[model samples]
Every structure is written in C-alpha cells, then in structure tokens.
Target: MFIALIALAVFFDFFDLMLSGSVTAALLTSGWSTRELNVVFLSVTGLGGIISNLVAGALADRFGRRRVFRGALLLVGLGTLACAAAPRMEFLIGARFIASLGMAAVPGVGLTLMNELLPVAVRGRWVSASGVISTSSLFAAALAGYLLLPWGGWHWMFIIPGAGCLVLYCLTAVLPESPRWLATRGRHEAARQALSKMHIDEDGPLLALNTLERSGEAPVDRLFTKALVKPLVLGVVLAVGFNVATTGFLTWLPMLLLERHLSISNTLAYNLMMSLGIPLGGLACTMLADRISRKAGIIGAAVTALLLAAAFPFTSGYALIGTGFVLQVSMGVLSTLIMGLYLAELYPTNVRARATALSMATVRLVMVFLPFLLLTLLNVAGVVGVMAVVVICLLVIVFAMFLLGIETSGKSLDRI
Candidate 1:
C-alpha cells in the first residue's frame, strides 16, 4: 500500500508535467498564446522549479519526508486548480509557475522516500516498478489531450490531475517518514517506529545508523567536499542531459509535427501513439535494474535514443511515429535509471534529499533558457536544427557515462 501510494503520487506529478506539451499546443491553436509567450510560460515554470527543488530538499532533510511530500502535493494541487480557471495566457503561465514548485519536488522526494524505506535487495526493482506506473501518465496526458483538446476541453486536462493530486495529498496522511532519514538524524526510536509501520525489521537500519557519519556541517556544504564533489557533478550532468533531451524533445515534438503540416488532431494522435513506449521502457528498466550496471544501461539507452532522434527528421507518417516510439522507450529507460535510481543512491542518508535536489535543480536551471535556444534553432534551421541540439545533448550523456559513471547497482544505500 505504501508503494502504491508513492507510485500514485508520482503518477499525478508526471501527468501534470507531460500535460504541458498538449496544453501549450492547444493554447497556440486557440490563439490564446504565441510562441514567445509560450517560452515565457515554460521559463517561469523552470524558475519556480529552481526555487522549489532547493527549498524542498533542505526541508525534507531537516523536518521529514512526509511533511515536505504532503505540502508539495497541496501546493501543486492548488496551483493546478488555478491553471484550470485561468482566463488568459498570462494567468495560465503564473499558475504553471506556482504548480512547477510542487511538480519539481514530488518525484525526487518520493524516490528518496522509497529508497530509504525499501530493503536494499529489492530497491532497484521496486523503484523501477514505480517508474513504470508513473510513465503511463505520459500516455494518459496524451490521450486526454487527444480526446479533449480537439473539442475545446483543454481546461479539463489540468482539472483532472489537479483534483487527483489533492486527493493524493489527503491519502498520504498515513504515509510514514523515512526510517533511514530518521536514524541519520539521531531519532533512532522514531526510525524504529517508522520501520515497524512498514513491517520491516528495525535491527538492520538501527545497526547501520551506528556507522553513519553524524556531521554538524550543513547538508548543502557537504556536497562540495572532495568525496562528494565528483558524484555531484556527474549527477548534475546526467540530469541536465536527460532533461535537455527528453523535456526538450517531448515539449517541442507536437509543435514540430504541426509545423510539418499535420492537423492538430492527427498530431495529438501521433503523440499518443509514441507515448506508448514510455511504460514499456519502464518495464525494461525494472527487468534490468539489478541485472546490469547503471552506467551500461544509461550509456546504451542514450546511444540508441540519439540514433533514433537523428532519424526523426527523415521520417513521416507511421515512420515518424515509429521513430518517436523507439526514442521514447529509450528515454524511459534513462528516466528510470537516472531519476528513479542513480541520483538518490549517490549520496548518503545524511544528505540524500538535499544532494538529489541540488542535482535536479540543474534541470530547471537549464530549462529556464532552453526555450530560447530551441526557438532560435527552429527559426534558423527548422526541425532539423532543434533535433541537432538534442542529438548533441544525448552524445554528451553517452560520453559522460563512460567517463564518470559510478556503478551503484546492487549496492546498499549506506555502503554507496
């Protein structure tokens, strides 16, 4: 039930995230927004994410995961409700900015909570399984857009996920705090109680806590130390690379398809079809999570995705959809490996949430300016130009993984 709730929370979080692509396209077709205004919308969302990631990470580490987790859901739910009622593009943009705060933190904090709660032996598989469930939201958002946007029902897209998140907020009241986090904070009894609630034996975590480094330094400060600096940089690079490739591609794909002379409904249909690969990719990750090295999975997926993306501009109709499906599958693998597993495992319990936040903040930071780059490329060199940028980002991931990738597969969190 705990895993199920965490998965559901992540599902809504990603539903809102993926819904933006179709909503932006709808706004464009409805004459409610321009390309430039869309850029502002996306940038503001990123900026809000930047602020939320840092703040939520520190708060989760200090107060408790359940507090920050529930608070983030309430914020996102309220912000998305405001989005559903927005009458103007500007108001919608403002609402998105507010929602982005909670959206940015939900998946990361949830992953952290899951990592700290689950046993080390099955951690990778369960985390990847949750990712499988969450990835389905990509398809859900696309289907919602396909069904609703054609009939001027774009508002309902925001309303559904918004309501879902708020309901999850209430449901999460029974969620326990991370026992590992509690132990690291010197709350051994609380940690034991949390473990009991999960039906997990408390002896292992309580014993591990005795060996944990109880430093007085700030969590953020510890990120800069020599032992951690390398992992920190690698984490940021992987995150930035993944975000640039996937977010940039997914956000712009519908518009790019529209520019290719496809009708709005057809474009959405193709998007929906391509989105089918996401959950499949997650399933693949769940199978490979413990069986393969993290570096190998990330590098292999990046190379395959890069090749598939390169084929995107050369294809049309079913061919385009085929290329995108394969590309999304590859991306799903990267998402589960990087966001679901790797980033949380890199740091110790003492600073896990904060470290993950700092790494993920780069996603928002790059996004703040990514629209400008993509737009400029789209204007200058067309779809091919924008894809060229994506290719470059994927290539970087491939190289970085080979050079700096730390193998965390099958390792206990405390040992890592």
Candidate 2:
C-alpha cells in the first residue's frame, strides 16, 4: 500500500507532464492557439516549474515530506481545475503556469520519500518499480488524447487529472513522514513512530538512525560544499542533458509529425503506438536496477537512445513508429535510473530533496529557452536538424556518465 501510494504520486506527475504534448497538439488542431503562442505557453510553464521546484525543496526539507507532498497535490489540483475552465489561450497559459508550480515538484518529492522509507537492499528495485507505474502515464496520456481529443476535445484531458489529483491529495493523509529525515532532525521518537507505521520494529529504526549524519548548517548552503558539490553538479548535468533531449523530442513529437504532413489523427495514432515503449522501458529498469550499477545502466541506455535518435530522421511510417517506440524504451530506462534512483541516492537524508530539486530546477531553466531553441532548429533545418540536436544531448549524457557518474546501487541513503 505504501509503495502503491508513492507509485500513484509518480503516475500523476508523469500524467501531468505528458499532457503538455497532447494538450498543445489539440489546441493547435482546434485553431485555438498558434505555434508562437504555444512557445510562450511552454516557456511560462517552465518558468513556474523553476520557481516551484526550489521552493518545494526547501519546504520539504524544513517541514516534512508528507506535508509538502499533500500541499503540492492540492496546488496541482486547483491549478488544473482552473486550466479546464480557461476560455482562451492566454488564460490556459496562465493556468498551466499555476499548475506547473505544484506539478513539477510531485515526482521529486515522491522519489525522495521512497528513497528514505524503503530498505536499502530493495530500494532501487522498488523505486524503479514505481517508475513502471509512472511511465504508464505516458501511454495513458496518449490513449486519453486519442480517445478524448476527437470526441470531447482537450478539456477532458485537464479535467480528469485535475480531479484525480484532488482525490490523491485526500488519500495522502495516510502517508508517514520520512523516518530518516526525522532522525536527521533529532526527532527520534517521531522517527520511531513513523517507522512503526511501516511495521518496522523499534530496533530497525534505532539502527537506521545510528547511521544518519545529523543536520548541520542550512541544507541549501551545504549543497555547494566540496563533499556534496560534485554530485550536485553531476545531478544538474544529467538532468539538463536528459531534459533537453526529452523536452525537445517528446514534447515536440506531434508537431514534428504534423510538419511531416501527417493529419492530426494520424499523428496521435503514431504517438499512441510509440508510447507503448514507455512502460516497457520502465519494466526493463525494474529488472536491471539492482542487478547492475546505475552508471552502467545510464550509459548503456543513453547510447541505445542515441543510436535510435540518429535513425529517427531516416525512417518513415511504420518504420518511424518502430524507431520511436524503441527510442522511448531506451529513454524510459534512463528516466527510471536518473530521476528515480540516482539523484536521490547521491545525497544524504538531510539535503536529498533540496539537492534533487536544485538539479531539477536546472532542467526547468533550460526548458524556459528550449521552445525557442527547438522552434529555431525545426524551422531552419527541419526534423532532421532537430534530431541532430537530440543526438548531441545524448552524446553528452553518455560522456558525462562515463566520466562523473557515481555508483549508488545497494548503498544506504545515509552512507552515500
């Protein structure tokens, strides 16, 4: 039940993230928005994400994971509800920005809580497993777009996830604070009580607490010190590289297909077919997450994705869909390892959320400019040119993983 709840949190995060692609495509087809307006919309959403990630990290570190998680859900719910009722492109963009404030932070907080709560030996697998559930959201979004876009239009897409988030917010009341975080803050009794909720014995909590380094200095300040700075930098590099590739490829997929002369229905159909790889990639990560070093997994998956991306521009019709499916699978593997396991494992309990959020903030910061960048690439050199850029980002990821990646598989969160 505990893992399931965390999985649901991750599911909604990915669901919301994936919706941007579908909603933008629908808006374009419906004549409600133009390409230029879409760029502004995406940029504003990214801006909101940047602000929310930093603030959410500090709040999670200062308050408790459970509290911040619930609060973020409420914000996402309210903002998404506003989006559903938006009357114009301008209002939708504003609502999307508001939704992003909460939407951006959900997965990071969910992963952090899972890292803190789960046992060390099984942590990577369970975290990756949650990603299996989360990645399915990609397929869910695609499926939703295919069904709802033609019949009910884009409004249903926002309405469903918005309502779902509100229900999930209420359900989060059953979640416990992170025991390791409590222990680091010197709240031993509270830590033990949290442990009890997990059915962990008192001795289990005591032994876990013994290994934790107590909180010191401001969590934000400690992030830049020598010991933490390396991982922090690595985290930022990996995140930026991944986001550049994904935000460029996945978010722009439908538009790219449309530019190829595919009709809206055909474009969405291709997307639905390609999205199948998301869950498959997550399943692969679940199988290999604990069996191999995360560094090895990231490098391998990135290389595979790079190869697939290079092949993308050369394929047509079913061939294009096949290449994309394989690419999504490879990306799915990278996503689970990097976001679900590697980033959270790099830091200790006290500063984990802040460190993760800081790295993620870089992702959003890059996102702010990506719409313009990708638009320029698409217009200048076409999809081939756009893919060349994705190829470059993947190459960077592979090089960085080989050079700076740390192995955290099977290591205790505190020990790392």
Candidate 3:
C-alpha cells in the first residue's frame, strides 16, 4: 500500500516527462520547425525545470517534505490543464514549463521520503517495481497521444496526466512524514507516532530501535565535503550523463524520424514502440535490483545503452522498434532503479533532500541547453551525431562508477 502510493507520485513525473516527443512532434507536423521548437518552445520547459528543482529542494528541507510534495503535484495538475487550453505556441510552452516545474519538484522530496520510509532489505526491490509504473508513463503518453491526436487533436494529450495529477494529489493525503526526518528536527513524539503508523516496532532487528540515532554531523550547506566530494561528483556526473543520453535521444526521436521522411502516423507508432522499453526495463530491474550491487547494475546498464544507441540510426521497421525497446529497457533500469536509488542512499538524512535536489537541479539545468546542442549536432551530422554525445556520456558514467563505487545494498538508511 505504501509502495502503491509512492508509485502514484512517480507516475505523474514520467507522465509529464514522457509526453514531450510525441506532443512536440504533433506540433511539428502542424508546422513548428526544429529551430522554433528548441529555441522558443522547449527552452521554456528547461528553464522551468531548473527553477523547480532549486526551489522545491530548499522548501522541502526547510518546511517539510510532505508540503512540498503536495504543492508540486498541484503545480503539475494546474499547469497541465493550462497547457491543454493554450491558444498559441508561446502559451503552450509557457504552460508546459509551469507543469514541468511542478513535476520537476518531485525527485528530491518524493524520493527522499521513500528512502526514509521504506524497509532496508527490500528498498531496492520496491523502488524497482514502482519504476515499472513510472517509466511506463512514457508508453501511456505515447499511446494516448497516438489514439487521441486523431480524435480531439493533440491538445487533449495534456489533459490525461493533468487529471491524473489532481487525482493523485488528493490521494497523497494519506501519506505520513518520515520518522527519520521528524527525529532530526527534534520531533521525537511525531517521529515515534509516524513510525508507529508504519507498524514497525523500535525493538525490531530491522530498525534495531535505532531510528533516532544521530551521527552528530554538522548541518550540510555544501553537497561536497571531502568525504562526500567523490560520490557527489560521481552522482552529478552520472545524473547529467544518463539524462543527456536517454532524454536527449528520446525527445528528438520524433523529429529525427520525420526528418528521415517517415509519415506522422508511422512516427507516432515508432515512438510508442520505443516507449514500450521503459516498463520492460523497469521489470528487469525488479528482478535484479536486490540481487546485484547498484554500482554494477548501473555500469552494466550504461554499457548496454551505449551499444544499443550505436545501432539505433541504422535500423528500420520492426528492427528499429526492437532496438528502441532494448535501449529504453536498459535506461529504465539505469535511471529509476540504480542511479536514483544509489544517489539517495549516498547522502545522509540531514542533507539528503538538498543533495538529491542539487544533483537533480544540475541535471535539469544542463538539460536546458541540450536541445540547442542537439539541434547543432543534427545539422552537422544526424541521429548518429546525438548518439555520439550519448556514448561519450555513458563512458563517463562507466569511469564514475569505477572511481566512486560504494555498495549500499541491505544497509539501513540510518547506518549509511
């Protein structure tokens, strides 16, 4: 039940992120160009992402995770509905940025809450299973866009997740504060109350009744102290690299196909097929997330993504779909299960939300300019050019893992 609620939170984010390729592609078919799409439209969304991360992270650290989480969902709901009613290109981009900001606010608070609340032994397993629903939002967006674009036009695509967000926001009322977070803030009564709600006794071996132990560390203003610098560097690098690799590739896919002369209907179908890989990848992680160390899983997935990306531009038809499926399957594992979970565990509770938000913020800020770089690359080379950048980033991830690898498997968050 707890995991299911968390899945609801994860679902809205992917629903927000996944709609871009198809939604933007529909606009392109209606006459938006490559230059206009990137410089004018997508840039706003990128800017929104940056703002959301910084603001949301700080708010959660100061005010509390639950409030920020609720506000973020509200933003997504309202922004998405506004997007559906947008009258022009400028309005659509503006509304989308607002929605993106809401969804963007999620990772730090939402994942932090999850890491604090979930069981130690099965944390990886639960996060991986939740990822199945999260990543599958891409497929849902694609299929919804594919089906409804013909009915009420592409405008209706934004409405689906808008409604989903509003519904989930209401349901989130049932969630509790993190006992770990409450304890840190000198709310021992609240902490105990929250823990009691989870039905875990403090004397249990699982918690060792030690949910209240403090490491006596000073408050963290910087994400990088000497002890944290290595993992922080690796986490930021990996976040930037993986996002640039997959989203950078996937967001441009529809345009790439259109540029290659595929018809709109076929382009929609192709992207839908590609989106299928998200859940498949998530499912793969569900099986392997606890079985292997996260560092190994991430490294392996990154290498596989690089290989699949290398073969992407050359394939056609069923083979093309197959390649996309496998590529995203690997990325889904790398992203949702390994990297997201690993970064949260690397930092301690005091600064966990802030650190996670900083990494996420940096990733989103870098991604803001990705469309510009991708446009330049497409002009000079093509899909292969984008893949070249992705491969380089993946290689960086491999290096980061080897340099900063630390196993967090089966360890309590408090112990870490």
Candidate 4:
C-alpha cells in the first residue's frame, strides 16, 4: 500500500517527462510554425527542470520530504494546465518550462521517501518494481500521444496527465514523512509518527538505525564529506553518462526519426513499438534486482544498450523493431531501475534527497543543452555519429559502475 502511493505520485512525472519529444513533434505536425525554436523550447524546459531539482532537493532535506513532494506535484499540475491552455508556440514553450519546474523533484524525493521507509534487504527490488509502474505510465503516455496526435491533437495529451496530476495531488496531499529523515534530524517522535502512518511494525530494524545528529553541518557539506565523495563524484558522472543515452537521445528521438526519412506517423509508430521495452526492461530489473548484484546488472544493461544503439543504421523491418525494443529496455534499466535506486542507496537519510538531486542535476545540465548539440551533430555526422557518441557515453557508464559502484545488496541504507 505504501509503495502503491509512492508509485501513484511518480506516475505523472513519468508521463510528463516522456511526453516532451512527442509534444514537440505533435506541435510541428499540427502546422505550428517555428520548427527551429521547438528544440530550444525543449532545452529551456529541461534547464528549468535542473534548476528546480537542485532547489527542491535541498529544500526537501531542510524542510520535509512529504511537504516538498506534494508541493512539487501541485506545481506540475499548474504547468500542465498552463500547457493545455497555451494560445501560441511562445505560450506553450513558457508553459512547458513551468511544468518542468515542478515535475523535476519527483524522482529524488520519491526515492528518498521509499528507501527511507522500506526494508533494506528488498529495497533494490522494491524500487525496481516501482519502475514497472513508472515505465508503464511512460509507455502509455507516449503511445497515447502517438495515437491522439492524429485525432484530437497535442492539447488533449497535456490535459490527461495534467488532470491526473491534479486529482492525485488532491488525493495524496498529506503523506507520511520519511522516518529515516526524521531520525537523521534527531526528531525521534516525528520518526515514529512517520512509521505509524505507514503502519510499519514498530519492532522492525528501522528503529535500530542510529540517528547520528551532527549539528551545523550544511546538507550539501555533508554530501561532500570524505566518506561520501566517492559515491557523490561517481554518481554525478554516472548520472551524466546515463542521460547521454535516454533523456538526451530518446527525448529527441521522434524528431531524429523524422530526419531519417520516416513520416511523422511512422516515427510515432516506431516509438510506440519501441516503448514496449520500458515495461519489459523494468520487469526484468524487478526480477533481477535483488537476485543479481546491481553492479553486474548495470554493466550488462549498458553493454546491451550500446550494442543496440550501434545497430540502428544497419537494420530495418522487424530487425530494426527488435533492436529498438531491446534498446529501450536496456535504456530503461540504466534509467528507471538503476539510476534512482543507486543514488538513493548511496546516501544516508539526512542528505539523501540532496545527494540524489545533486547527482541527477549533472544529467539535467547535460540534457539542458543536449537538443542544440544533438541537432548540430545530426547535421554534421548524421544519426550514426550520434550513436557513436552514445556508445562512448555508455562506455563511461560501464567504467563508472566498475570503479565507484557500492554493493548495497542486502545492506541497510544507514550502513552504506
């Protein structure tokens, strides 16, 4: 039940993030002018998201996770509503960034809350299982955009997720705080209050965690302490590495496909087909998360993604579709399963949200300008050149996992 609620909170974020590329394409297909500015709009919105994550992550730590999480949700709803009502390309672009600002914090805040409340032994699997929910929503949203754009157009796409967010915001406005966060702040009673809300048995190992209350140390300062620097540094690098593939590439994929001589309908069709792997990879991660070492799984996923990405130029028909399926699945592992769970597990409760944000911020920064670079690269080197870059980035991910990966398997968050 607790996990279900967290999943519900994440649903809109997943939907909104995946919708950007399709939305851009949809707007173009609908005869909206200014094709050059669409990429800029996407980049600007991504920039807004990065800024929001950095601010919200720290604020969630300083204030409270539940409050910050709910507030972010409300913001996303507002952005979505604004988007639906946008009168022109300019208004839609501004509305897009407004929505991104609020939606940015969901992953970090949700990860912090989930890792803090759930058992350490099954934390990886539980988080990965939650990816099933998120990725499913992503696929659904993308497919919905694909189908709806031909009929009702882009306006309704925004409305669906926006309405979903408003309704969910109303329903889950008041949720339990993270007990680990409460304990980290030395609020024992508040910690117990959190547990009571979750209905977690009081006799569990949660109470056994030592609440190390260090006064006066800033949250960001704590993240950079000697013990955390390795994870922090590697996490930020891996975070950037991960984005070069999914958020960087996939976000621009629809337009890229159009550049490759595919029709808009065909582009959406391929995307709808490729999106099948989101849940497929998520489901695999759910099964393997606790069973295999996360480090091994991450390495494997990167290799798979690299190989499939490299094959894009040579294949078509079912072969192309197959590669696309596997590519998205592997990317899903890098994205939905590993990134969030890995970052959250690397930190203690006190600075977990901040660390998660700081790490994710690196990716968002890369992705903020990714559209411009991607367009330039496509013009100069074509899709194959872009794939080469993606391959290099995946290599970086593999090496980062080897050097800085922490074995969090079956271990408590406090012990990490």
lDDT of 2 by residue, 63-129 (tens): 8788888888898889988988999999999999999999878888888998888988888889888
Whole-model lDDT values for every prediction: 0.88, 0.86, 0.78, 0.79
Candidate 4 residues lying further than 4 Å off, grouped into runs, are 211-219
Clashing pairs in 4: none
Tens-digit per-residue lDDT, 10-107, candidate 4: 87778887887888887777778446778778787778878888998889888888788878888888898888898888888888888888887876
In order of lDDT, best first, we have: 1, 2, 4, 3
**Model 4 RMSD in angstroms:** 1.8
Candidate 3 vs candidate 4: the TM-score winner is 4
Error of 1 at 315 (Å): 0.8
TM-score of 1: 0.98
- Candidate 4 lDDT score relative to the true structure: 0.79
Best candidate, TM-score-wise? Answer: 1
On lDDT, the stronger of 1 and 2 is 1
What ordering of candidates by TM-score runs from best to worst? 1, 2, 4, 3
Q: Give the TM-score of candidate 2.
A: 0.97
**What's the lDDT of the predicted structure labeled candidate 3?**
0.78
Candidate 3 lDDT over residue span 1-416, tens digit each: 66677677778777777778777777766664446654556667767888888888777776778889888998999999998898877788888888988877765578788888887878898888888877788888888878976444777788878888898889988888877777667676777787888886762433233433443223554556787787677768877888788766777777778767898888888888888888888888888888988878988998899898888889988888898888888888887754458888987776677777778889888877888888888889987887788888888888888887778888887677
